[model samples]
Target: RARSRGRRCSVTGTPLLLCCYLAYLALGTSVFQALESSAARDSKEGSKSDNWTSLLNYTCLDRQALDRLIRDIIQRYKSGVIFLSNTTSMGRWELAGSFFFSISTITTIGYGNLSPQTMGARLFCIFFALLGIPLNLVLLNRLGRLMLFWVQRWALWLGGAQKNQARARWYAGSFALFSGLLLFFLLPPILFSSMEGWSYEEGFYYSFITLSTVGFGDYVIGMDPGRRYPVWYKNLVSMWILFGMAWLALIINLVISLLESSIVLCPCSRRNPCRT
Candidate 1:
């Protein structure tokens, strides 16, 4: 009777959790819309006003010519060629830059900072992604397992007995989460802020966005054409991204494990009365 009641409770819990998740999403959407919609509208109006003022001030070019020039500039920006400086020999399609793009693509980050402009390149990208994404996942899984093995070994070395191994594993997971947050989240932002000349908050935002694979593309590393970067800089960032993703996967697995354990161990359910 108890086992059947427990199973019933577990079955019902799924729907309850789903409802809660949906509600959370709705709340977030409402908050973001309330906060940003008006600001976005104002910004669009300001941009139009500025463009009109610029059109009026420029007597050398007619409106049609100015419009054509603007269109050309926008097209060049979209093609990722507008940022290239005359002094810099590096380009978006350089060998190092292409390698960075491949890493981002396989990791599913898709920063949108650079993309294949030609149809042939685009077709090749499509095929590459189909295979590369799954292969990246496999690599991440193996890296995560290797990390977990070391974490478990560290937990055992900390004197976790056979009976208390589960508790030790939980502690180890917590430690790993803390370490990952420090290494990937906290430390990297400081370096990015110093190197990219961004505010600390912006650096932190970029770090979180990139590692989470949200890839908003508002701020990408090593994209400034005006400044020279080390030849190995992009490669180093790519390695950081790959390892950070593996760490993120491990953290997600730990969280899911914790949630599952909590659900299973919960004493109070629809079928099971809470003991005070």
Candidate 2:
């Protein structure tokens, strides 16, 4: 009974943890939106102030007068003076933005494009990552097993190896290798390049670097100055990063699993060659 309970908990752990993460994500989105919106408004007001200040210079007003006015306006908004709003609430820290940050933290990607500016947020991130990393590891392993199970089942049916365990394993492993390469590595570059207007080489390079978690912070999506993307579009990119990390984890674990099982000869057998 205890073993059965253990199995049940293990099976339920992934979804339960996922639900909590999503709930936390929802709360973060609401709070950050309010914070970012206020910041943007203040920034817009600051720019209007700056433009007015510039007019003083054109009219040859006293240098001291321009300096005093600018200082007073900046001191009023405080840190909003630095946010530099793009006239849109398209902050680098929105719902999808926070979601991406959460995913990157859990996956150990650490893109560093966006980070917590406040001390409280930084401390919270530290604790969140401490717990979230282990949960992410467990979830990735479970996902790998689940996906492998279905892939192997398909392979067995296709190869007519339903009754043959060894043949099924071989066929499934081979098919999985091919499919994993196509789905994770090859197709993504092409798809990303088309959607983000990146060169094919740049797309492939970004995909490789991101999945490997090197996170150089060179290329980013939806950051075009001339073009603004929809909210759903940004969210979709975050979803892609999450799923791509899962697939990468699955492939790495699958390879490790294979290596561990590959050594067919036991230590006892190796020492008793005369028995063979």
Candidate 3:
């Protein structure tokens, strides 16, 4: 009877948890829009004013001509022609870029910087992703478990057998989280900042966003056409992204385990299995 009642409570609580999650998302959306919308509007207006002033000062073109020029540039940019540089011989559809795109697609980190334009290519992409995404997920799951095993071993070495199993697990989780932050979040940003000419903070933000698979497309690497990059650059970045994502997955799993264990140990949970 008790087990059946507990099961019922657990089933009922799921909807309540889902409602709370939706409400949290709503709160975040509202706060972000309120904070950013005004600044975005102001920036847009300022940009228009600056463009007009630059056109008037530096060129003989009138407003109508400027508008036409802007339209033409936009058209070319949308067609992916303007992305090619006169000085650079590299094209977006090259092998290295395609490899990077494939990795990004399978990892669900579609940066929206590059995409297939042809119908056939798009169809292929859909089929490729259908298979590759699951394969990538399976690989990451195994890698996460391997990483967790190593983390536990390190924890045991550090804390020794005198520590309780729970304490050892906590130590392992903490160590994994800190190590991942340092390797994926902190150290990589320094290199990115130097290589990309971005500020440290921007590099850190990009690392976090990319590893989280948000892929906002604001700060993609190796997209600049004016400057030449090494041929291996994109491949190296793809490798970094793969490892960082796996590390992040491991950290997330550790966090979820910790949360579940904490809930199981809660005093209210002992009295009511579905109290959460």
Q: Which regions of candidate 1 deviate over 4 angstroms? A: 1-22, 48-72, 80-91, 160-171, 257-276
| Ranking of all candidate structures by their lDDT, best first | 1, 3, 2
| 1-276: candidate 3 lDDT, tens digit per residue | 667766676676567567767998999999999999999989889877986788777878888897898799888776666544452332377776687788878999998677788899899999999999999999888877888788888777766775577787787777778888898889887877766788999999999899999998889887666666776766667777888888988767768777544543232255655433
lDDT of 2 by residue, 1-276 (tens): 545644554454546556767998999999999999999989879866886677675867676787787688776445434345562333356766677778888878877666777899899999999999999888877777787789877876866746777777788887777877777678877867766788878988888788777777677666555666777766766666666676787766668666433323112223332111
Cα error, residue 152 of model 3, in Å, equals 1.6
Candidate 1 residue pairs in clash (backbone atoms < 3 Å): none
**For all candidates, what are the clash counts?**
0, 0, 0
Question: lDDT of all predictions, in order shown?
Answer: 0.79, 0.70, 0.77
TM-score of each: 0.77, 0.58, 0.82
Q: Identify the superior model by lDDT, candidate 2 or candidate 3.
A: 3
Candidate that beats the other on lDDT, 1 or 2, i.e. the better one:
1
Best by TM-score: 3
Q: Tell me the tens digit of each residue's lDDT in model 1 across 57-101.
A: 866787788778889989988876655455233336777668778
- Model 3: how far residue 32 lies from native, Å: 1.4
- Runs of candidate 2 with Cα error greater than 4 angstroms are 1-91, 159-168, 254-276
Clash pairs, candidate 2, are none
